[model samples]
Target: KVDQSVVLAGVKMKNPVVVASGTFGFGREYGQFYNLNELGGICCKGLTLHRREGNPSPRIAETPMGILNSVGLQNPGVDAFIAEELPELRTHDLAIIANISGNTPEEYGIMCEKLSAAGVDMIEVNISCPNVKAGGLAYGTKPELAAEVTRMAKAHSTVPVMVKLSPNVTDITEIARAVADAGADALSLINTLRGMRIDVNTHRPILKMNTGGLSGPAVLPVAVRMVWEVANAVDLPILGMGGVAKGADAAQLMLAGASAVAVGTACFADPYAPVKVRDELAALAEMQGISKVSDFTGAVKPW
Candidate 1:
């Protein structure tokens, strides 16, 4: 029998399939479709220090191979999540990764402390949010800013900390190395590529935010490339994501160097996407005569 279990940065998962943040929404909605314990982990919706109303209407739009969203991080504050959501999530057998976004390093530190004390298995820091004190530049775009956030989160959190890297940057490895040096235990990459669409008839942008992050099969190649680059550059374990819809796609990322993979946009089309990917991945492992799924990580040949 193939061992589907994977150990990512000291956290053991039953499998390598995890649902990405902002798409899984605490796993309550998708729980109706299948058993939440079937997958490896769940990165909960992005949380801030306070509740956010999010952007105006028409924040989501359909693109050719994916979707663009500027949901503006609409979520209940961290306090509410700890009180109302974490308890229910604890009942599941999988690892619970809390994804947090903040406008400042101090804010990230505070949330990390709160979430870690609340008993999350790990913390996924979302540095894609604009640093309000830095003239609105994304923390993930600059190595110093990214390191600052990582350091602060590391200082405050008791559990493992994973920094999510943005694909908008010119060199993702620089940010990855910076975070690794700053004490990040793991990394998740290719948060979302910046993209936009316009209505030819109305002469207006489709999303209310004018532009938003693009996610879906459209970004798979870029995600794989970045994951491969960062994995080669840094020694930290990676939780790779972007446009993964099938077991083959997940295997591609694993072979590229990701210790684990996350299913995103595809979940919108099919709530069973994560479980399906997990089962198919196990089948593929068995067919390959591989006794363990974890052996797929960084197994790609560069020729």
Candidate 2:
């Protein structure tokens, strides 16, 4: 039998199919479709120190091959999540990863401390949020700022800290190296690429936010390339995510060097995407005469 289990940065996952942040939303709605325990891990919706109202309406726009979102990190706040969501999530057998975004290093540290104490399996730091103290520059766009945030989160959290890297950078590998050196336990890569859609009839932008982060099958190649680059540049385990829709997609990311894969936009199309990917990955592994799915990690052969 093919063993699907994988250990990502010291956090044990039943399988390698994790639901990406923003898409899973604490696994409540999707929980109705299937058993949450059937998957590997769940990276809950992005959380802030305080609850946010998010952006204006028409925040989501459909592109040719993907969707763009400008949700603005709307969440129930960290305190509320710990009080209202953690208890129920703890009952699940899979890993519960808290995805957090903060306006400052201190905010990230504070949330990390609170989430860790609240018993989350790990903290997925979303440095894509604008750093208020840095004059609204995203931490993930700057290597030093990204490292600073990673250090602060690692310092305050008791659980493993996995910094989620943004794809809106010139050199993702440099940012990956920075976080890795700053004590990040693991890394998740290729957070949505910035994009926009326009309506010629109205002569205006399609989304209320004008531009949003693009995610879906359109970004799969970029995700794979970045995952491979980061994996080769740094020695940290990676939770590669972007446009994973099926088992072959997951296998592609794993082969590109992701220790595991996360399904994001695919969930909007199929709530059972994660489970389906997991089963398909196992089947593919068995067919390839591979006994363990983990063997797919970084197994790509380049010419």
Candidate 3:
């Protein structure tokens, strides 16, 4: 069997197929369906400082070959996560990654402080989310703001800290390097691209939110290119996602320089996508004569 173990940010994972944030709720919901230990890690849903009711009705809109979501960083707040969700989540016995968001830098810091004490394996700051319309996209698109936020989070976090980046920026590498310089342990890309869909009958926005973040197979190629660029620019470990739907799709992201692959939209269709990806990666590694999947990281064949 080809070796798939990866030691990322001091977290030794069995493989590199982690469930994306927002896609997988705090383990309890999906745990009933699959064995959580089978996967590498869990990037739980976007958590805020306090419990959020979330967006109005119709938070998710289906489009041709894609999905648009405005989840609005809804959560039971950090305390509830630790007091309630974390206790049950710790039962999974796998590396746990918390994806966090807030309305401002101070809020992000507070969340980091609370989650740090909760003994999470790592924290992924969800700076790319656009649905909240506050401190979400503001921190992600600008290089300076992204770095500042990364710096503050790293300051407050005791464990590994990763900044989830947005693809809507003109230069992703610039922001990647900034985050790395600000003491980020790793980076993840690309969060959902900004997209909007209109209603044919009413001619208004389909969702009451008006706009949402787009993700799925449609954004995979762009995510690959961004991963390739960021990996070359920064030496920090990179987690890649956008439209990973299959084993080969996961492999492609790894070859593009992502140290690991995240399953997002793919999970929507097949709750078993992560399992399938994990198996496919192992099989492909053997077929390619690669003893370890990390050996192919950033090996995007330059044609």
Best by lDDT: 1
Q: In candidate 2, what are the lDDT values of residues 1-303, reduced to their tens digit? A: 999999998999989999999898988887776799998999999898999888888888998799988888888999999999889889999999999988789999999999999999999998764212231237888899889999999999999999999788888999999999999999998888888899999999998878888899999999999999999999999999989998999999999999999999999888988889999999999999999999999999989
User: In candidate 1, residue 131 scores what lDDT?
Assistant: 20
Tens digits of lDDT, candidate 3, 1-303: 799888677888989989999888887878986899999999999888889998896888999979999878778988888899898888876789999988888888998999999889999998898888777888998888888888889889998999999998999998998899999999999999988999999998987898899999999999999999999999989989989988899888889898889998888899889889989988998998999987878888877
Tell me the deviation in Å of residue 147 in model 2. Answer: 0.8
> 99, model 2: CA deviation in Å?
0.5
| lDDT (CA) per prediction | 0.91, 0.89, 0.89
lDDT (C-alpha) at residue 142 in model 1: 88
Model 2 regions lying over 4 Å from their true place: 129-137
Task: For model 3, give the 10-residue run with minimal summed lDDT.
Answer: 294-303
TM per model?
0.97, 0.97, 0.97
Q: What is residue 263's positional error in candidate 1, in angstroms?
A: 0.2
User: Model 1: residues >4 Å from true position, as ranges?
Assistant: 129-137
Can you rank all candidates by lDDT, best first? Answer: 1, 2, 3
Clashing residue pairs found in predicted model 2: none
